[model samples]
Target: MRTHKYRTTDVAVDGGTLHAGVWEPVETIEGAEVPTALLIHGITASHLAWPFVVAQLPDHRVIAPDLRGRGGSHAVAGRSSMRAHAADMQALLDACGAESAAVVGHSMGAFVAVVLADTAPDRVTRLVLVDGGLPFDVPAMPDLEPEEVVNAILGPTAERLSKRFADVEEYLAFWRAHPAFQESWSREVEQYFAYDLVPVGSSLRPATSLETTIEDMLDLNTGSTLTDALARVAGPHAVRDAGQPSVLFYTVPRGLQNEVPGLYPPGYVEGLLAQHPVLEHHRFEELNHYSVVMTERGAAVLGGPLREAITERPAAVG
Candidate 1:
């Protein structure tokens, strides 16, 4: 196993301090420049989500941040939107002195990555979107409230945000019972869940704010920011430019609960790729949404593609 140094830093952004996790390469040449890769986590997750992925990337400097409404930045005062998250990323890059980086995002972070690439194309060298970034084919319903929509999409994951646990172990117990993590559970996974707890009087609640999650969930699914951003990068002219970043998208076969037709179903993905043509698609057969970036096996499978994206030059796709 390759070991790396890890530390947390608070970066100043538009709203308030944003907490980020930085992992340095175990060995570095005296005068050579080390490449940087930015990893962004999901809606209700923290920077801890990248530990397994970071282990797979021993040759690069890895930085992962708790999005505005999640993890240690739960108290960051602002409405959680794709643009807001992208702005925070821009500030994080500046603070770390990383002029350009290979950007990788999972879940909602992928949406933010798309927005960042659109808003600041010069800062992104390439994009690797893990199980997100593209729009989902959700059924249109005009009568549904935002919370109802979130509940329908996220199911028990969103429900857990409202419930309180007796302690950290209690929270761990809850996650242990989840179908997604039963086979992939490890000490790293335990640490990831443990770090998610904060005291709520006598009990502990997940640090992610329910209101913020609902706002972000609804925005990403229904808002125009992602739609507009995707149009700019997925368009023909953008893909024809060798100077523009290339995009790689990975999808899983199962979802949060080990159910088939994961976030991006097979048919949906085929149609999406057919439409965009710019996105290169890869599928992980056995992994689900959570394990794709959080488990050792999943990280091992993803390491090669990530390394290629970080070191290879951008090429025209269409």
Candidate 2:
């Protein structure tokens, strides 16, 4: 297997400096162009969430960013929304000198990827939406506020944002006992969690901002940006264009807690495929939502499909 060199760089964006992680293949041809893959992490996750997947792609340059309001970019000044996030991604691409890339996103990151493709179509070559991008079938509750909705959807994941830990080990212990990582635990996972902590007075807190997360979730679940973007790229009209980049959607059977019927339920996803045949669906029955991109097993299963997307040639137009 080929090895890679990893580094972190600061990308200038609208609100402030965005932090990004880049992985380059150790060996490259003297004059050949190397393809780039941009991986977006889920809500409340850092760029570290992608190291496992990065290991599986040895030939392409992989770029993963901590979105404006998360991880090292948490202090970025602005209202967090899908469109804003997309703009940051565009800036990151420019900073990396990539004209276009094979984009892969997990959870909320998938939503950002869709908007980036629609708003800046030329910057995206292909898309792999892992466990995100499609709208959820959330029931209407006119009486509920946005925070209530976020709490309901994210549960403990969102609550953790407001927590303060005594140290990195304390935070690590919390995740070590989580149901999602109980069976998939590893040293890499520990490092990912430790990177999430930021100093706050006498305590350390997760770098993700609660207000930003709430704003983003509200936009993703209730705003029209994603809905319109999905239509333009994967809707009936867009499907007719052979020049559009190929899109692949992968889903797992379980969710954050290893519960059945994951983020995209089987029947619901089938209906989505029926409505938008342009999207190709792949299912991994053994993994859950978190593991689908964070675990070695999940990354191994995705290596083949991701490589195919990266190297695939566009179909010849008639």
Candidate 3:
């Protein structure tokens, strides 16, 4: 049985309108301000990817938006950069009347979360980075071409943007065969895939724009804003109030596929954790890149740590 409810709202951003999916609890506290959490989806995803996580957070209001070029916000014009995404987030928060929020981002959304915190630290109170936030060790691969890097990193996800399906069911068939879903399929996955389809001519295509996908992917690897944010979040600088803000990162052992390793390169995350005391990491051996947050079990497991972060204050970093 469905127990949660979500609302769709639009806000005027710098370039165009931004569409958001906001989930509210079944019951509310009397007169008290509801704490909001900004849930950011991956590059090729929308707010629908978070139904399971939203289900887990009954007390806190979850505000999720289609970041510029996907879902209901796919038509939003202008540039789609991390900084632009961050500014849109600020506008969404303002529209929601939330002065601050616990920022939760998945995949590329995690990248935007870090940028949001770095660009506007005051707006963010705590962070939960699910399989993203830090740079993905692109520096280590000096020999690979830029396109090769994106292809290597994104793989089938990037390829699916151009493919057309006869119907949403056809799209579901494609995903059912995917290794990630073969073992752990659910209604949440179906809803997420159905929302991914947008009508194009007589057929249906993914709501995500191919140009937006490649542009964002390239920027994530080369963008100065992301690395700058990471440096601020990681390094002790004059910019921040305390040291690093409390961070809890959940990652998977395998990549989107069987042979590929998870997004973060080998030994990369450990080095980053070593430098930043406030950044705590958890590695899920049984889950893959997609299953880490997509599956129900993943969300239930992720929820325990996530709930603690929501209520618990950041331990002071020395």
How well does candidate 1 match the true structure in TM-score terms?
Answer: 0.96
lDDT scores of the candidates, listed in order: 0.87, 0.87, 0.81
lDDT of 1 at 194: 96
Ten residues in sequence with the least summed lDDT for candidate 3:
236-245
In the range 154-250, model 3's lDDT, one tens digit per residue, is: 7787788888999988999999998878987898889989988899999998998778876787788764888778777655442335544467787
Give each model's clash number: 0, 0, 0
lDDT tens digits by residue: candidate 2, 1-318: 646899999988887999999999888888998889999999899999998899888888999999988889988998999999999999999999998888899999999999998898888888889999898656775588877888877878888988999999899989988889999998888889999989999999999978988899889877588889998878877764555455788898888888787778888998999877778899988899899888999999988888887678733111
Every candidate's CA RMSD: 1.8, 2.0, 2.8
Cα RMSD of predicted structure 3: 2.8
Give the range where candidate 1 is weakest over 10 consecutive residues by summed lDDT. Answer: 236-245
Instruction: Select the stronger candidate by TM-score from 1 and 3.
Output: 1
Q: How do all models score by TM-score?
A: 0.96, 0.96, 0.91
